[model samples]
Target: MNVETITKTLNSLDQLQRNTAIQSDLFSIEQTSDLTVAAALVKTLENLGVRYAFGLFGGGITPFIASLEQSSIEVLQFRHEAGAAFAAIESYFASGHPVVVFSTTGPGITNALTGLFAARWEGAKVIFVSPCTSATQRGRWAFQETSQYTMSNTGIFTSGTLFHYATTVECNSELSEIARRLALGVGKLGGFVAHISIPRTIQTSLLTTPLPHVNFSPTLVTAGEDTISKCLQLLCEAPFAIWVGFGAKDAALEIRQLAERTGAAVMSSARGKGIFPEDHPQFVGVTGFGGQNSVLKYMQEQRPLRVLVLGTKLGEFTSFWNPVMVPSRGFVHVDIDPEVPGAAYPYAETFSVQSDIGAFVRAILKYFPEISRSSSVLPLPRPEREVIKSHLEGLVRPEFLMDAIQRVIVENSDAIIMTEAGNSFAWGTNILRFAAPGRYRVSTGFGSMGHAGTGILGAALARNRKAVAILGDGAMLMNNEITTAVKHKIPAVWIVLNDARYNMCDQGMNMEGFHNVDAEIPSPDFVMIARGMGADGIRVSRECDLEAALEKALALTIPFVVDVIIDPTRPAPIGSRINSLIFHGK
Candidate 1:
């Protein structure tokens, strides 16, 4: 058949298949006499599997909050709107379910900008709901007014920079379309943030018609036969490695199978840690700032002929965009987003295939049996595990802290480990060995401080697992949601590495041969702060007291904080990137 006829036939078949599936999945609308817009909104969200809504309550959003109180969805109140938004994002990360975040008006929505930005950057699925000035009193300077029609430079939320879909619902008729958009946004692959602003007047409006249920069944994108053939041809040539990213989290089993079948050495981006078992013989270390040197050495010395880039953008933090990390031969890139293939490294020869990571891996697995006997590729040599048990001296060192945490994790294998940006992330990513996916959570793309401090609460609640948030003293002081955790009775352990300064910044300046005094900052006793917040607290300054304190913290039913005074003089483990940061500018 001709290309045009073939394409037409395939399109018709796809539409027919979708129609058949939709017929089965469609929900019958049950008409209710007294369904307000607020109730309809909450019911739609509940139908979409949203169980929790995090935010502060205010007069502007009183109706919506009241409706939520009547619904099955649980409302989690936070001191700050940003904390609530961050918590929702983290919850989505843990559960793979989009959560709702609310804000009042004007400043409430603006305060949530940072968290929303981080959510967008990390590709987290979050629905942001906020109240706007009443449609009747929009331009006449209403109380806490936040209407795009009246405010100046207020387009940030709706500017498409932070949200996949942003809309202000002024009428009851818009709710159905809004519900459909939200369902579609959440159903799509990768993270998406949707913002819906409901005017105060519309919240109490009675919905005349029954709310329509959206039929959401995302079709899996798989590699075509031609793409598979090309990939197979590339794999037939040995000495190729696989690079995995956070997008490949669901394809862990298939990834492992592919690596073993081809005898390919596997490395991962920082966010991709624990996707493939790091302890496996075929596993090379992570690629990034806090990455393993042995992996870099392997890439430098035993240069791979080609690389199969799986679901990673290979951005500045991942590859540093340096030639040293980029394979000399070329790369075959696979990603869910069609635009992400050659975005980072356009200079290199990139064979791009847009497909879901799991489906793509499974597709590649089918061809593995055919070429299994013919492929004679060998895995890279295993890197030596650096023993740092004896490195514990007078003051608590970063390495010693990592070792202790590793020991604690080994004992409590089910606990989810999280880290804030800076030294905490570097130490955790480098030292902590996660055997499975969903155990290690870190926000490296946005790299926002105080993210884990608040985000851990949502993660703990979502996973129903003990969450250990290892963060810097600065981050802990910035926005610790310990109060929220305590209020909700979440089992969260906060390990504060208190160096009495922004150690990452201080060390970076020192490495660059520049002396900056602004890096040093006074830190309050976190133990006392935790106790003040109605949570248990412990102070551990010595190395010997570390593991015991961790054990005690882990056993606590409520939120607990372990404040460890780390040595400020000791440098953070920021491998080769120091020179790159210093000399690249010169």
Candidate 2:
């Protein structure tokens, strides 16, 4: 590999470093050969600290694949290109490491769209590279040939900003400079950054390289001084409710301080589970359909004077914009994007400002004068909590079952937890907390099923952490990637919540008075499936068996699966069941 010098300035790197699981001190601005662009891409990938790339092998990525097979980085080839991309994204979300993806020129890029889009929604640092038809084939109906800037034009779709043709770089000479610009985008833009290209004739044939260290000047188009001052003034005067979105990641510290100082209640969307620790007294729980049951009850009674949403998109799942589910008062949307506020609630009397989340919160703390405010009253009693706890205990046995899972991880200092999203996510997120980095990861944005199996695989490879996948049976079936896990010797604890049905869908069906035809599933002995996949597994019907099994599995240096039968009839305690039920035609 040829050592290449770096160029370009990226402000996004700082925020990216903290916000991302993939932290990097060095990245290369590599140049490629006619035959060596593939090798160079792999070299650049190594510089980025990537251990794996997801996607199928095709003409454009042939060289990259061949070299990867011989190198340390392993290529995960999946049945569908989408799954591969999702695996890459899930890995990033689960392990916080940057992932790479490859595709052929056209169809490959198309298949990669969903996975890449998922990363954008959930904030994963993904790099997608594709081979294009040669430059000579430009307009003459060559395979997969289009305008040079097509992909770049669409690149900024998830970027939260308007993008034009200029966003894309043409040919190889411009590749490194473009790669540098996009690389800086990891944190600032907080999504997958693409360095798409075609053949050798296009990439290596070009000659100009842009400045590697060019800084992107950030302008807060949405927030002005007046908006900031008014927001701080409102926050200073009242006991506000703290609602965070996945986007609120940049304001983590500020959100924590607000909750600590004002005795404010903190609640986040399911996607924002880790924004604040559930153990914090100020922390209430999740906010929507799948949120912690206690949170909704508390919000109704408190009627916090203002709800400060930091760096969040407060969408359907979080608010449903339902008056009963959210804080019933003025909502202050603190986002970098100017247009997202009040979009979820049309009738809402809202105060919104567009600014960098952390920066604005800092301004508020530093510039706003403190004022006394009454505490927001806590809402309903532990009615749902005691009930759900009862149901969980009765069905699963032993109140310590979930607690034991946490304790086991605590015992294994090297443990890394990865969960598949579902009702299980609420239980998983509520149970675990991260003290150090690279400990817990999940891909909640794409919210794809079948991703857990592959996600755990990717996380194990990228971080080499002792990864565990807590998944619903429905989610596990999404991709039988256990074979990949076993094949790679990337062992992770796979905990399957076996209910013999899609609980979420079943519950929704019950609301509609429809026969629950499609939801019921044949309960699979997940252990047998694991053994078939060349991994060890255990089926625990009794709660007492779970603790010892997890301990034994963790001790094993290979991937293991645990299938725990859970009662599907249980409803999570917290929000009104009517909201979720209504979707079922009730």
TM-score of every model versus the real structure: 0.93, 0.77
Which model scores highest in lDDT? 1
Quote the lDDT for 48 in model 2.
53
lDDT of 2 by residue, 131-241 (tens): 665655666766665445444435532233222112333444554655444545543544555545546354344234322332333333235445554665676566677
Candidate 1: tens digits of C-alpha lDDT, residues 1-586:
2334334444443221111111124353877558889889998899888988999988888899999999888899998888888888889888887899998988888888888889998888888899988767878888788876656534455747778898888789788778878887777778889888888778888986668787787777666766666776776665688999989999999999898877788999888988889889888898877888868887888778889999899987788777877776789999978898888888988899888888888866755642344445444656556777643457799888888888886447588888999899888888888778888888878888878888988899999988889999999989888889989999988999999999998888888777855887787899899999999899988888888999898887889999998888877778557876765677
Relative to the true structure, how large is the alpha-carbon lDDT of every model?
0.82, 0.62
Show the lowest summed lDDT stretch of 10 residues, model 2: 1-10
